[model samples]
Target chain A: MAKILDGKEVAAALKDELVAEVDRLRKQGITPGLCLVMAGSRPDSQSYINSAVKRCSSIGIDCRVKKLPEDVTQGDFLKIIDDLNTDPKINGIMVMRPLPQYISENTIKYKISPEKDVDCLNPINVSKVISGDDDGFAPCTPAAVIEILDYYGIKVEGKRTVVIGRSMVVGRPLAMMLLARNATVTICHTRTRNLAEETKKGEILIAAAGKAKMVTKDMVSNGAVVIDVGINFDESGKMCGDVDFDSVCPIASSITPVPGGVGAVTSTVLAKHVIEALKLQKGIY
Target chain B: MAKILDGKEVAAALKDELVAEVDRLRKQGITPGLCLVMAGSRPDSQSYINSAVKRCSSIGIDCRVKKLPEDVTQGDFLKIIDDLNTDPKINGIMVMRPLPQYISENTIKYKISPEKDVDCLNPINVSKVISGDDDGFAPCTPAAVIEILDYYGIKVEGKRTVVIGRSMVVGRPLAMMLLARNATVTICHTRTRNLAEETKKGEILIAAAGKAKMVTKDMVSNGAVVIDVGINFDESGKMCGDVDFDSVCPIASSITPVPGGVGAVTSTVLAKHVIEALKLQKGIY
Candidate 1:
C-alpha cells in the first residue's frame, strides 16, 4: 500500500508555525485580519466560510465575514470591496465567488487592493503568479498542494509534473508554481487527447478535474506521487477525490485522501496568506 | 523532406488584412499610431526599431521612436511614458526592454496603459492572457507564432503540444495561448530532465529556448509539426533557430525557419496590435 500523504498532519504543522508568527505579530500589537465578503447565503459558501473562520480563530487571526443581500447592486458590492480595500484592520480580503448574477465579477476582482487580495483574485496578483514573482499571493488551495509537497520533502525540480485541469484557481496557477520550481509541467483538460497517456508520464500527477473517481489505477504510473485537489461527492454522496483512491493506492508511492487531503490543508493555507498579507501591508518583510 | 511553414506568406496575408483595416480606420480620419520607447541606442534595439518603423509605414501606421540617453533617470523615463499614455495620437506604446540598469523594469512595465500596451508588458494584459480573455494583447513574438499556425490551418485543439522554454515573452505566454485553444500544453525548460523524452511526445513542438541548434533530429518525432521561435547566430555568424534545421527538417512533417519564420511575422503582429489598440481605445469592434 502507498504511504498516505496526510493533509491533516501538514495543516497541523503549518498551524503550529502560523501560531508562533501570529503570536509574534500580536505581541507587536498587529493582529493579522481577514474579511470574507459574501453576497448571498450560499450553503456551500457558508460552510466554507464557517470552516475558514474556525481555522483562523485557532491560529489567533482575526476573521470577519460581511454578508450582503443577494439583491445588492453592483455599485454597492464594489463600494463594500472598496471599503475593505482601505480598511487598515483587514489585512486580507476574500470575496466568496460565484457572486450574484447581476454583479460584475471583473469589477469586484479589479477593485480589491492587490496587497490584501489573499485569494489572488486581482489581475496584478495573477500576473505575479505567472511571472513567478514572490510578491503576489497564490490561491490557497493550490498553495496548499505545495505546502503538502514541502512538508513531505518531495522534490519538484526537473520532475515531469502533469496537471489534469486548467482552471485559473488551481490547475493553471499550480502548473506555474510547479514550473517555477523547475518542474516540466504539462496541463491536461477535457479537450486533452489520450488522457491516460498524459497522466502516466507524470512523476507527480495532480488531479484537479472535479470529477469523482475519474483517475484510475491504469491512468497513474507506478510509484507516481498523486495529489488530488478535487472535492466531489460519489454516487452514494460520499466525499471523494478525483482519484479512485482504493485502486490507485497500492500502485502509487503516495496519495492524498479527499476529506483528509488537500481540502484539510486549504483553510490553513488561507490563514497563512492572511499573515503574509499583513506583512505585505505593513512592509514587515 | 518537411514542407516549410512560410513566414513571409503568413506576413503578407496578415499585412493585407491589416492594410484594409488600417485604410478603413484612416477613412475615419483616425490613423493608428505606435510609440517605441528606448532608453539607449543599443544596435540590436535600433535594428528592431528600424524594421518596426518600416513595417508600420507599410501598414499606414504612424510609428515613432523615442530615444533617450543611456543614463536616463527612472523618473524622466516614467515621465515620457506618462506623456505617451495620454497622447491621443498614439494608440500603442512599446518600451524596448533591458532598460538602463538603474531604471526599474517592473515600474516601467506597470506604467504603460493596458489599452496601449501593444506588447502586453502590463500585468493587466498578462493576467488577461492567463485568464484566456481576448481583451488584452499578447506579446507580438508569441502572437506571431499563433498567426502562422492559424494561416496554415494547424489545429491546436486536443493536440499534445510541447513548448521548450519558459520565457515570459515567448514560451510561457505561448503555452497559455495554446492551452486556451484547448491543446494539452507542456512547458519544458533548461531544468527539464530527459529533454528528448519530453520533446518526442509532442505532436506540436515549439522551440523558444534561444539556444543555437539545441533541438536536433533525435529530439523530434516523425511527422511532428515544429514551430521554431529562436533567433540565434551560430559559430559561422549564420542566423539559425534552436532546431538543427538540416537534421530535423527531413524528420518533421512541417517546420518554420528562424529567419523567414517567426521573426518575419513578428513586426506584422506588432502592426496588427497597434490597430487593435486603436480599436480598443476608440471602442470599435
Candidate 2:
C-alpha cells in the first residue's frame, strides 16, 4: 500500500495553528468572520454549510450564512455582496455553488472585492495568480493542493506535474500555482486525446475531472504521486474520485483518497483563509 | 531543410486584411488611431516605434508618437497616458518598451485605460484574457502566435503544446490562450529538470526562452511543429532563437525562423489590436 497523503491529519494541524492565530488576534479586539451566501436551498449546500459552520465555531471564527430564494434578482445579489464587502466584521466572503440560473457567475465574481474574495473567484486575483504575484491569495482548492504537497515534503520544484480538467476553479489556477513553485505544469482536459499518454508523464498527477475513475492504473507512471480532486459517485452510489484508488494505490508512491484527502483539507483551508483575511484587514501580514 | 512557416508572407496577408478593414471603418467615421509613448532614446525602442509608425501610415490609420525625455517623472508619463485615454481621436494606447529603468512597466501598464490598452499590458485586460472573456485584447506576441497557427489552419484542439518559458509578457499568457483553445499546454523554465524529456511531448513546441540555440535537435520529436519566439544573439553575433535552427530544421515538420517567425507577426498584431481597440471604443465588435 502507498503512503496516504493524509489530509485529515494535516487539516487538524492547520486548524490548531489557526486557533492560536485567531486567539492572538482576539487580544487586539479583532473578530475574524466569514460570510457565506447560498442562493436556493439544496441538501448538499446545507451539508457543506453545516460542516463549514461547525469548523468555524471550532476555530473561534464567526460564520454567517445568508440564504436567498431561487428567484432573487441580480441587483439584489450584487447589493448583498456589496454589503458584505463593506462589512468590517466580515473578513471573508464565499458564495455557495449553483447560484440561481439567472444570476451569472461572472456578474457575481466581478462584484466581489479582491480583498474580501477569500475564494479568489475574482478576475483580478486570477490575473495576479497567473502573473505569479504573491500579493494575491489563490483560490482555496488550489491553495490546499500546494499545502498538501508542502505538508508531505514532496519536491514540487522541477517536477513534472500533469493537471486533469481545466476549470477556472481547479486545474487552471492549480497549474499557475504549481508553475510558481517551479514545477513544470501541464493542463489537460476532456478535449485532450490520448489522456493516458499525457498522464504517464506526471511525476505528480492531479485529477480534478469530477468524474469517477477517470484515471486508471495504466494512466500513471510507477511511483507517481496522485492528488485526486474529483468528487463523484460510482454506479453503486458510493462516493469516489477520478482515480481508481484500489488499482492505483499499489502502483502509486502516494495517493489522496476522495473523502479523506481534499474534502478534509477544504474546510480547514477556508477557516485559515478567514483568519488571513482578518489579519490583512487589521494591517497585519 | 524544413518547410519554413513563412511568417513574413502570413504577416503581409494579415496586414493587407487589416488595411481593408481600416478603410471600411473610416467610411463609418471611425478611424483607428494608435498612441505610441516612448520614454527614452533606446535604439530598440526607436526602431520599434519607427516600424509601427510606418506600418500605420501605409494602412490609413493615424499614429501619434509622444517622445518623453528619459528623465521624465512617473507622474508626467501617467498624465500623458491619461491625456490619450481622454482623447477621442486616440483609440489605442501603447507604452513602448524599456521605459527608462526608473519608470517601471507596472506603472505604465496601470495608467493605460483597458479600452485603449492595445498591448494588453493592463491588469484588467490580463484578467479578462485569463477569465476567457472576449472583452479585452490579448498581449501582442501571444496573440500573434495564435494568429500564425490559425493562418496555417492548424488545429490546436486536443494537441500537446509545450511552451518553454513563463515570462508574463509571452509564455504565461500564451499558455492560457492555448488552454482556452483546448490544447494541453506544458510550461517549462530554467528550473525544469529533464527539459528535453518535456519538449519531446509537444506536438506544437513554442520556444520563448530568449536564449540562442537552447532547444537542440534532441529536445524535439520528429515532425513536431516548432514556433520560435526567442530573439537572441548567437556566439557569432547573429540574431537567433532558442531552437537550434540548423539541426532541428530537418527534424521539424514546420518551423518558424528567428527574424521572420514570431517577430514578423508581432508588429502587425499590434496594428491589428490598435484597430480592434478602436472598434471597441465605438461599441462595435
* Candidate number with greatest DockQ: 1
What digit string (tens of lDDT, one per residue) describes model 1 on residues B85-164? 99999999999887888799899989999999999999999999999999899999999999999999999999999999
lDDT of 1 by residue, A103-200 (tens): 98888888999999999899999999999999899999999999999999999999999999999999999999999999999999999999999999
- Candidate 1 backbone collisions, by pair: none
Per-chain TM-score of chain A in candidate 1 equals 0.99
What TM-score between 0 and 1 does chain B of candidate 2 receive?
Answer: 0.97
Q: Which stretches of candidate 2 lie over 4 Å from their true place?
A: none
Winning candidate number (TM-score): 1
Model 1 residue B213 CA deviation (Å) reads 0.4
Clashes of each: 0, 0
Best by lDDT: 1
- Model 2: per-residue Cα lDDT over B123-208, one tens digit each: 87998887677778898899989988999888889999999999988999899999899999999999999999899989999999
Which stretch of 10 consecutive residues in model 1 chain A shows the poorest summed lDDT? A100-109
